[model samples]
Target: MSGLNLKALRKAFGPTEIISGVDLEIADGELIVFVGPSGCGKSTLLRLIAGLESVSAGEILIGGRDVTRVDPARRGVAMVFQSYALFPHMTVRQNMGFGMRVNRVPKAEAAERLQKAAALLQLTELLDRKPAQLSGGQRQRVAIGRAIVRDPQVFLFDEPLSNLDAELRVQMRAELAALHARLGATMIYVTHDQVEAMTLADRIVVLRAGRVEQVGAPLHLYDDPDNLFVAGFLGSPRMNFLTAEVQPDGQLRPLGLDVDLPSPIAGLRPGRRVVIGCRPEHVEIGDGPLAATVKTVEQLGNSTFVHADCAGTPIAAELQERWGTRADAALRLALPTEKTQLFDAETGLRIRQ
Candidate 1:
């Protein structure tokens, strides 16, 4: 429906800046996710876009119109918050149609919108039920349905599934994806859960502190991160980092193991300290130059995660097969040259070739 733009967007409380200058263009009908750790300004940014928080300095354009100072109700956007925020006394039908009623929509139009949203969210059968009678997932659906009836140009979800159980969260995630596809509405979602961002977003905007670190398709950012933080943050079990020093012949010595640099990096000089990174899946076990002591073994049913200590450096490796390996056992691990990443130790930036 509508594309959203932030030009030098910023927000501050008192003298402390919470959202720094951020510029992003979200295409019409695109589902963009803002992901980061707690207190990383993801929620602040979302609130700013919703007009719930005043912008400290910057411009917000929605559907090509400047709405930086517009009222929240007039911004053509609807928000589903972490809490359901439903009126316990109101039935699903009444709650979903409350906004329409407040806006003086025609009775017939409001009824029609309610029916359509209920049917779309599979809440048609629960219209007469109150929030107290509904399950967590059902209540969340009611909240989303309320937003849907508004027919907003953009939809903002602020960790809407965080309150649900693990199984319900997974179910709701799939349902949300389906709903997005059906409506084709522009959506901005904020979450600290990287799994949610990876599975739900058309593109992910990774944030830290109050600044955007990287914005791209999920896999793109995962495979080609621009900095060490992005690489370490996006993956489960996280990437393994080992301190190393560059040798004259493009080789690196990490933890008494010699590994050739993955690629030629510009500005890399001999004796420069660098960090070598390898994902769990890329760390081959049972055969390589690096010797480690197994610290822990996690049996995840289908796969195993081996955490080891190599000369005081911790490393984890994922194995397709179940290993009978126990703690305190010695193992050799290898870091494949093609799969390894190099980073500047001082700057925590990727050493680009």
Candidate 2:
């Protein structure tokens, strides 16, 4: 078991900074996910932790030892990539045991670890199959089993599920979670998909450009994002942003429609430009305040999404039960006052609580 502590971690490509001063503590046996949009440095940070890339600054401590400059093989960390880097000619068993064999570990001991890992990944029956013979999901399992056989202090997964189909990705996600529970080893997963980050991570690190935006439990980040970027980035279907102004009585006027705000902000001057943010699920269709016209309708059996234009403001609503929804239909929406989030229009900063 191992816990990782990062202090002022920074990475740069020449003069361009990639990871700007990130500090985080990953608990032993915890599964942490790093998520962000493209060019957000999520994968680069993972590589830095794996010793696959050099750190421009800051320290990386694993199990109380600073391994910032440690060799990849000496870091006691193993990684699984999105593309399974399996030897085409080697059978599953050989691929899983190759590292141990190269390290000159006894054949019996190597086989023992392989057997245990294969069992955990449910790849025991496919041990004799080559990469060409196994399915994508099976190949991924072999890749993970390879890492497990190493008995590393930490496991790093860099978008390992991105290459799988939607159905297989979901299946593999559950498998990875179960695998983590069985082993209780430190894990760091990096992905662009917020669904994966939300479901699999014990804690999430949301990054943008080079700096860490926020780090917390999945729900915490979703419920209380530090800035507009995080508030919009964490949810499915994404959060809706509406033009709003802070009123004289400390209320939010969304699209000229009055709505109450829970957190006190009386100091905000009247007509102060602010961005009103709320999730799709928080939007309710009713004969009230905000006005929009339905532009498209998406029916997903379990839930229906209504894409509407709120007086030129595009709004998407996720409904548990779709009773009345039509394309190009005019609709009025009531904004949830207490559940609302406000961001400064100029700086995109969340108005101080």
Candidate 3:
């Protein structure tokens, strides 16, 4: 029953609006991610839900009860921030149990809660260590452990892994996913990283300019996006957009490559201009209608990324095996008819059949 519901949520800082007209529902035990570029209000929305900021309008409900005006401490949730926020002088055990101690929770209860959280987070071995003695990952674990000890109905993470190194971020992501599975507690996470959003969330809320651009399961949004912003934003290395125009026969000529539109875009007619989107992995490097000159090649052991120029538009193609093409080499590219996406040139919306 610890689900979250936002009804026409809005937030304004004095005269300027930050979060505008958002409506969403997060089911109990779901790990939902709020992802976007910096200043997109993802963090602000998380704060609004956590009761850290006053709502300009609308209502916030958690576990079926309204808590718009409730104090953050009174809400049945715990938050972990980007900063570890650990007490430098305190041991891991002490820091984890501090909240309960301040609330005058009995000594035995606090100790038990701390013990359980530490065990869950694999911090039992480091309980005696101080923040100064621990690495970034360990400090983060302590922070998360502190939140877990509270036994809140929901957990909020505000880019908790951003401070960690690349290797540690991957480790923490796996750990957090495991923790979510084990606890089955409702969680809301905010991050500007799309990879984290795709790998960590059961559903992702993509934000832009203080508004939600789209929300859905990660792959659903990746495979079939609602508009150009989402299609370009959700994928790594980004989806490619090449200039295209609808032919008199209803086929599309995208970067001089002819392809039939998907079944969903049946309404598009001749003489209309559109953008053709193809993910890097979808474009085949072989003989086809389009020709490109490789401008750069990225070799990453298991795969290769070819950056090229087709006419004037930049194109990126990914290959699973090793590629021998070097800079300035000529290559033919093919866009599979079934794998391409069409968007209206004027509105920047996916043109569906």
Candidate 4:
């Protein structure tokens, strides 16, 4: 297996930049996911590594070899695209071995490799079936099996499961995770789905508008983010942000709700404007100073989420059980003093503790 090293990677299209300077390292056998919203350049960066796109500036090193200028086929990598890209006329067995045949690999060796890949992907029985005869998940497995037969140094996936329905996506994600453990091959997957990134990545690289925002383990980024964007983007239901101001007495008032500070931040001195972030799970229904009128309540059997408006600012709280609150009802919730996160209102960057 080979690791990937990208140094100062950049790509531009006629005067417009799509990928800014990006430097990343993927360890051997590690699954690294590039996650961000659309137009964020995650897919572009993956293409650069796969040698499908040329770099405007900087270098790409695979297994310590400079492959920035190498052709896609010679870069020791195989990519699985969002589309299955399978041949409709060919059987699964033939499609999986097509790459090997084109490269002039011996027929016996190619057959053996195809057989092993089919067994690993649980597609041995489907080898005789054409693309139209297979299910969506089976077709995706065939695409992956095709890549596996290449025996590439690194694997590149560009939203390979995006076409499947929600349930199938979940099933395929688990299968891909198990496959990684079995093969121990270095893989870089790109997706706009944060849930996929959190569950599948050994480490996540968050990007925004072609530049890296933050990179860390899933929970690390969720627990402590570099800025408002990373904090709000990583979590489900999103983190809540409210405008606040630091008083002369060094007290923080967010929508008139007093919150204690953990420590003094450089830009958070007395009278500085700041934003307070609270996770829905961190809020609790209790007797507190903050009050709101319920706007909506969602009961999902095991849990409930209450959406409310406090002095025109929206706040949400998640509870283990249903609260049965009606619209326009009054409710008071307490914010965990320690769990609240503060960000500089001007720069939107977190105030490190």
Best candidate, lDDT-wise? Answer: 1
By TM-score, the better pick of 2 and 4 is 4
* Per-residue lDDT of candidate 2, residues 1-353 (tens digit): 79999999999889999999999899999999999999999999999999988999999999999999989898899999989999999999999999998888898899899999998888989999999999999999999999999999999999999999999999999998988998989999999999999999999999999788899999999998888999989998888998777767777766644454432355777878888888999898887577688888888888888888875678888999855656777777876777777788998888865
Extract clashing residue pairs from model 3: 264-352, 264-353, 265-352, 265-353, 266-353
> TM-score for model 4?
0.96
Worst 10 residues of 4 by lDDT: 258-267
Using all chains and alpha carbons, the TM-scores for the candidates as numbered come to 0.97, 0.95, 0.96, 0.96
Q: State each model's CA lDDT, in order.
A: 0.93, 0.88, 0.90, 0.91
Instruction: By TM-score, rank the candidates, best first.
Output: 1, 4, 3, 2
Cα shift from native, residue 106, model 2 (Å): 1.9
lDDT of 4: 0.91
lDDT of 4 at 11: 98
lDDT of 4 by residue, 208-264 (tens): 989999999999999999999999998877898877888776667775655544323
Off by over 4 Å in 3: 255-264
lDDT of 1: 0.93
Give the Cα error of residue 202 in candidate 2, in Å.
0.4
Candidate closest to the true structure, highest TM-score: 1
> lDDT per residue, candidate 3, 1-353, as tens digits?
29999999999999999999999999999999999999999999999989988999999999998999999998898999999999999999899999998889899888888889999999999999999999999999999999999999889999999999999999999999999999999999999999999999999999998898899999999999989999999887799898777777766766455454432256567788899889999989988668889999999989999999988788899999988776999998877768888888889988876
How many clashes show up in model 3?
Answer: 5
lDDT, candidate 1, 286-318, per-residue tens: 678888999999999999999999988999999
